[model samples]
Target chain A: MSTLTSPDVGRRTTGRRGAVARVLAAPLVVAVLGLVTLLWLQSIELDSIEKRTLNTDYLVDRVREHLLLSLSAAALVALLAIPAGVLIHRTNSRVLRGVVLALANIGQATPAVGVVILLAIVWRTGFTTALVALVAYSFLPVLRNTLTGLAEVDPATREAARGMGMTRTQVLRRIELPLASPVILAGLRTSLVFAVGVATIATFINAGGLGDMIVNGLKLQRYPVLIVGAALVAGIAILIDWVAGLVEEYARPRGL
Target chain B: MPKPTTIIFPSMDVRGAASGGSATSGGGVSIELDSVTKTYPGQDVSAVEDFSMRIEPGELVMFVGPSGCGKTTTMKMVNRIIEPTSGSIRIDGQDVLSLSPDQLRRHIGYVIQQIGLFPHMTIADNIATVPRLLGWSKKETSARVEELLDTVQLDPAVFADRYPRQLSGGQQQRAGVARALAADPPVMLMDEPFGATDPITREKLQAEFLRLQADIGKTIIFVTHDFDEAVRLGDRIAVLSERSQIEQFDTPAAILAAPANDYVASFIGSGAALKRLSLMPVTSADLSFGAPASGGKRPQLDPTATLRDALDLLVVTGAEALEIVDADGTRLGCLTHAAISAALTQSSPTRGAGPAAGEGVHR
Candidate 1:
């Protein structure tokens, strides 16, 4: 019996060690990338057009706007999509669940640029429209994941919970939600990174973000500005993903 | 040579004795199911039609039948997991149907074949589920969890903080049993609780459960398709047929001796006589004090072991006689094939005398 179980114990130990290594490695990798980008930028001779877009104040302002748009959209998705998914699950109506899932599929199927451009065309272009577009673009992953996670809970486990005299609400809160959390957290992480990528399109609607640098650089043919803009957006997305990964690990129920 | 003597062992008849006669033992409460019927929506035929049985307090009644016999549905109705379309269920003379289902369930311990220990919770938390739901204080709940883990033979220090997946199948099932018994509910509903275990583990668990039942005496409705398990663990085995029909509701010895009808005899299969022996302890037989003629350190049997065990030892070792010993391994006497046969003949007169024997058969 001990021989049979020893392998599982060993595997679990290695898995924990892997997670710890990842937690420590992510920040170090991000820092190195940031330093390399700074060195590369400083090595080049910048022209007037490049200097205008790449100044510290201009760059910092763009980064702030970019972070604000993506983070808030991801936050709103977490708040709205999870409950909506749970409500659809609770209704236990196949038709309603199917409808919501189909709508979510369509939302995801539509390209991020199309969503941003189309929303701006129909509604007025600005920060609000861009925020709405980012939210719409990232909603599907979290919603789909919530439904999938809940559905995947073992029926036997659910029956036992109910049989033990746990009320419907109690079972959901104590059993179902905890079991479903890992998958849900994975979905949230995906959407967070997705929001960071899509928030770049907000610049098209006259919203100020790192995308402004890219647009200005492209029009004026300033390679330095465009590279810096693209690199910073990439950096933010990676860092957000790393932080979400840490949160996912921390928030997961211990037994799971 | 010394003549054989009949040694009267106290509690020797306890296994085959009718539970109704000793219903007042332990924390058990009586359950009365009166003419309960359940018909699924859109179906004309009732799944469990007019099913009725009075389970005595402290009785462990086994519902043994083939699949789709509606046995599970009948048991589920007691705890209101599955509502009956008609009729009623009462626990300890209290109308279970009238009470709130959730509140009613909290008082009835429930176990199932799946042995569903929550994957996300530690063993302690899973066992503490009911106590916490009842708003027990943290200290009280933790103490109860520890007590239950110990009752199920899991070390609290080693197993309490571990998740269900880390445990073996047998250990997980033990945890499942521990969790059901956490609040010490008077009535327990077990749906083939040991069905998923392998044969060896199942036997060990059955023995342990029987010992536990002797202590707690909780009125339990245990469902199983295995006739051998029913005979071994149940005080009274309810041989069920289609539509949850009670073909025979009697003690294990009574049913094995005289099955109510052809269906029951067939359900009992080829091992009726052997099954009966399993219900009778080794002390039921006469024993001789004479030393074996060719003694060469003969095999010994425990005093508490069943006659079936004695027979197995005799056959396996090909011994003419085996010594019976108490827990201290001191020789009580020697048992032979003749003594076992004599005991079987002596028990024949009391066959079919169990409480509710041949009472619930409705053609």
Candidate 2:
């Protein structure tokens, strides 16, 4: 459901801080917990640089790659989900909606790693393969929310649009879609956040994203490098999540 | 699906609004239905069949029936939202079948109980939808939106920029009405436009809609299950039953005076006894003008109000007689308690007419 549904849809629907507050909070909590692991791996006398920037000595490059791959996947997923959502919603065909729902459920069930591996073996892939896997993994929530949001629109509003001389498509655009927007945008927020975190594992195959540090840090059993690499990826995921959530909060329609 | 160069529905003689307080006398709408039938692919029974009627332009005709009796299906057919499997419907003397479904709907306005407002859009943008769709200039659309908001009694500034969620139920319903009236189409189709509201709100809206109908007089075909609403609002109500066929299509007075069949009689029920009061105004016709009761200050009474309503004032004020006032509140006659009782317990609308409804001049 959209945050704007009830005017007070969530405990925190939208404000300057409320949207990103949770997103920012979760990663910090996880990272602070990860501090214990860091302490166990590194000696107390280690140099600050060795401890803090080992795995992520190249955070800037990795962050940009992770962002590019995640964003690209998210955009494609949106394009697919929105049209499918509209078709399933605006039309009276139940069969198509059911099939789409089932497909989305399965998409959601697919593990990010399994999908990456499947795509890598079947298709000639490195970056694109991971991108496809990320997109597929993140597709369901966006698709489901778009469809659900459209479906929840009051039918009376649509009929009123018809009475006002709007054709079916006009009614869908002018009435249904606008009313459904918040929920659909929320779906996009979820997909984008998920894609960000999932894309980090692509570094395992040299897909050349931020996941590289995470993989190398793990393999070498490095202390500071592993901590830094994991922290940067976690931070990037939180950032994208924070941004998408902000969009969802601000762009959400207030009521119907 | 390949484009069928020619669309399924067409556009023709756009309607000229018949605006006035009275919907019946403004637009000369003549609608006809002939053996209309619709059967879903898997359903054995038809939702509507052998349904036929004619309504004059500007007439506020209502379709009323029990739930799931195809009243809504029949309404949808007018706009071709649902196609007729057999038979035809004509609006303003033109064949409905010839027009493509899309074209047919554009010429008609539609409304329903849910009061569906576009939550993302402000009141002004929502009202401007049709005009915007037809390529009207943004300025023109904005001006029309303001005019409509005002016409519907919504403050242009307070409501125009606010989204649907901000409005109260009553305000939302009013906005819905305003939105339906935006394009000024000749024919407007409504299905339970006030059904979702509370009784008092529904009654207020019924009166407001009646007043609006007087002004817009769009060829209106409204559907409701409330008999009192049908009587209070419709110029004529088409009582339907079973498979959506009209049981009786006539004035409300006629329906109460004489039910067409058992279905209508039961539908009306004990309410008919109370409804007769609505038609019984304490007119000069009902006043006996008892020899001047030169006494205490007489209570004021509206000449057009029914005896049942007037009786309360007469009894509460302990007035020997009430000075009847016309529409302008000028004294026209004197209505005593006796006169009101005589008028209220009169038993029927007309002295000679029996309970066969659809008889007399209305039929």
Candidate 3:
């Protein structure tokens, strides 16, 4: 019996260790990638690439612009998607929910590049058009995740809250939303990463980002610039994903 | 397994203990339902029809019936969880319909079989839900949570900060009960609150629940399909049938002795005599048989044990009689199988009265 009980204790200790390792693993990988990128850039003789892409002023400006566009689009998507999902969930009419879900599906089903090009044609290409296209592209995941999170809350818990005299708003605020936080954050994380990847297309309309380097490098046949530009974009994506992971860990409900 | 060195009996005279316990903080209001009926839309028959009963303050009345018999519907209507098609409900002589549903529920405690403890919340936070809703101070709410944890026989130190998943089924159910009792509501509605626990755990919870009720004395309407549970905890049972119609309503002993109809008799099944033995305390039976048997060892029975337990002990020990003793180990009297049988067969009108066993007779 003592032996039988000992394994459970061992498993619990290992489980905690596993969680800690998971939290550390993402940032460690990103750090290693950053060090490799720096060393590889140093080893290669690419003075031309260094002047245009690796310079402090050029890299910082492009990276800042990339981050600004992606963060804005993600914020907008969250604002729209979460409430839409909640409204769809709270409404009793099947037709209404069906209609909203159908629209979301259509938005996601359409190709992202097509959405960006179409917006560029009609609304004019630039940061604004790119932001709008990114928001539309990122909407589905956030909305779907929000709906799933709210739906996943145990019905018995909702009934108990109501029976305990909580108003509708109180139930949503104190119980439902807190329980749904981790999933919602996961949705936001996906949207943010998608937005970062999609923002690369904004350079086609001269929005000025690492994408500018890639498009220019391609046109000018500068392989060194192209490599650094592509590497930087990948690096930013990984960095943002790591940051979102931290947010998710912090936002996860305790004592669950 | 280690052999037991001591036997702790179930509390005797639960009613007296309950009444005494409620004296310090008294707040129970009588409830009366007048010809209550509920019929769902498009349904041919009403779910519950012409349901009416008076529940005295601080009493635990169990609604016992088969599934889909509308026992839950009737109870829900009291807190307006369900609206009755007809009839009025009054708590403390005030019409329940006059108050808003949320307002009415604030004063009524509800516990369900699923336990429904919020997975995101700590045990203390779960218990503090209603108190916080009612705008109690943080200090007051925390104190109440601790008090309730203790009341349900859970340690506040070990459980307050823990999550519901950290607890066993029995512990979770206890926390559920504690949550219901948090705001000290005068009335509590329990829908098979311990139906999910295993047999051993359920028995322990039932015993603990009885002691808790004995202390708090809240007016409780408990719904369950288990007759044994109803008999163990209810002061009176309302046996309902299809469409929430009342078949028989009476004390467990009264129902066991004389079932109102064949339906009730069938529901009771067999072994009612043995069931009745559980209702009366061992002291209630005449245990005045003269002296213990000389020289030979005999089994001991606690005075707090029921007559049914005494009968089983006599058979198990293969003795004509056993000595009944109090907590102090002092011999009270001898309990014989004949006395238990006589007590079971007797039909005395006085409440809890039983047959008196005669003095010593050699086996």
Query: In model 2, what is the error at residue B90, expressed in angstroms?
Result: 1.0
What are the per-residue Cα lDDT tens digits for candidate 1 across B21-136? Answer: 22223367788999999999999888999999999887889999999999999999999999999998888788888777777776678999998899877788888887676666
- Pick by DockQ: which candidate is best? 2
Under the 3 Å rule for N, CA and C atoms, how many clashes does model 2 have?
Answer: 21
The C-alpha stretches of model 2 lying farther than 4 A from their native spots are A1-57, A87-92, A122-125, A254-256, B1-28, B271-273, B294-299, B314-331, B336-363
Off by over 4 Å in 1: A1-12, A15-21, B1-26, B286-303, B317-335, B349-352, B355-363
Better of 2 and 3 by lDDT: 3
Backbone collisions counted per model: 0, 21, 1
Fraction of the reference Cα-Cα interface contacts (below 8 Å) that each candidate reproduces: 0.53, 0.59, 0.57
Summarize candidate 1's per-residue lDDT along A2-54 as a digit string, tens digits: 11111122123547777788777867877888899889989989988787888
Residue A170 lDDT (model 3): 83
Candidate 3: lDDT over CA atoms?
0.80
Error of 1 at A6 (Å): 21
| Model 3, runs deviating above 4 Å | A1-21, A35-54, B1-24, B286-298, B325-333, B348-363
**Clash pairs for candidate 3:** B18-B214
Q: What is the lDDT of residue A165 in candidate 2?
A: 52
